[model samples]
Target: MYNRIILKLSGEALAGEKSGVNFDNDVIKAIVGQIKKIVSNGTEVALVIGGGNFWRGRSADSKMDRCKADQIGMLATVMNAIYVADFLNQDGVEAVVQTPFKCGTMTEEFSKASALNHLKNGRVVIFAGGLGHPMFSTDTITALRGAELEADALFFAKNVDGVYDSDPNENPNAKKIDEIKCEDIIKNNLKVIDLTAASLCFEQKIPVVIFGLNEENSIVRAVGGQKLGTIVTV
Candidate 1:
């Protein structure tokens, strides 16, 4: 089992399959339950949640300034972190939201030391605000935080079960890659993660697991080394 891990959750996973809703309570609760199980087993966890559920900067109108749109995207992540942290706390799990930028008293400013301290003390640390800058996705933040915190592995709780040779939705013959290297992922330009994030994971020698959030107890199983999805290694 991984002693510590950084779990990257896409905002869309929080929304599940619901349309016109910011969150799916059942999905969030199920995820929280799995997290609680892992924590009780003594595995430390930190999280980086994406903002695609609320907004995607790249999907914004062309008339909007790119930087401004990204700023709004960053704020959307903060909102997600706040909601998840609150839900975790309410479920009797201690969780804290940390941001790269200030959120007036809503969240703590992120620092490697502080985040590590929280994990060591059994508090779940949620890193939000997407590196506090534009042109950076939360995937990049996940790799960065995993490196900074020396996590045993990075867990990507995505909508898909694993990385595939082609888009599974489009190609019926697309094969799920059970294991892969970061260099190959980058060289082949796979969509498992952005190039920037994959490069960082390679440089830092961080192992990553990508799994479907909808799978039963996926997070817990992934951390326990069950090989529920694709495993990416340096």
Candidate 2:
């Protein structure tokens, strides 16, 4: 159903066995293996990844000041981008990392035109550093890039299988939603995307597929419109 899609991955998914703040090479390769399958299916992909595995911005501020914490979080994302891009390249896929904040020798400047150029060239562009600003999550960047690139949909892949009424990890009785409206996510306070990200997609009339990356070939399934997760739409 989607020709071009923006895929968002949580940083925690990159951690193999460790609880958090660690990189697992095998996990990165596993994801890129799935990404290769999606690309082979003639789907163009752009990526935005969170930095929670290395650093959580808000949590870092509990020890240091807010701005300093945010910067540390941004650097963590840049490191992930570098590793992910390298892994994709090793898998024989052309991948580029673009950051909203400049990191010489690591990534290119983040811009809609540059991203489109990469997509047109059949390169997977990984957008890093969460819109290059503090207080904005990678979810917001995912929505913004989805709208800007005119992608058919946004695929939000995390550790969980799909969107739930409550935090599935914390609530055993939480029900997984197959589909939902953007308004329901907002009004019901569903922990899908943040308010700003949800609002952007709603206003842009963009469809989102919230799915799990734990399963193999999940990205391909998402692009193929398989019934693998919850659909959030207007």
Q: Per-prediction TM-score, please?
A: 0.98, 0.94
As a TM-score, model 1 comes out at 0.98
lDDT string, candidate 1, 1-234, tens digits: 788999999999899899999999999999998889999899999989998899988585878888899999999999999999999999999999999888999999999999889998999999999888899889999999999999999999988899999999999999999999999999999988989999999999998899988888889899998978899988
RMSD of each: 0.9, 1.5
lDDT of 2 by residue, 153-195 (tens): 9999978888988888899999999999998888877777888
Q: Where in model 1 is the C-alpha error above 4 Å?
A: none
**Which residue pairs overlap in candidate 2's backbone?**
none
Clashes of each: 0, 0
Model 1: lDDT of residue 59: 82
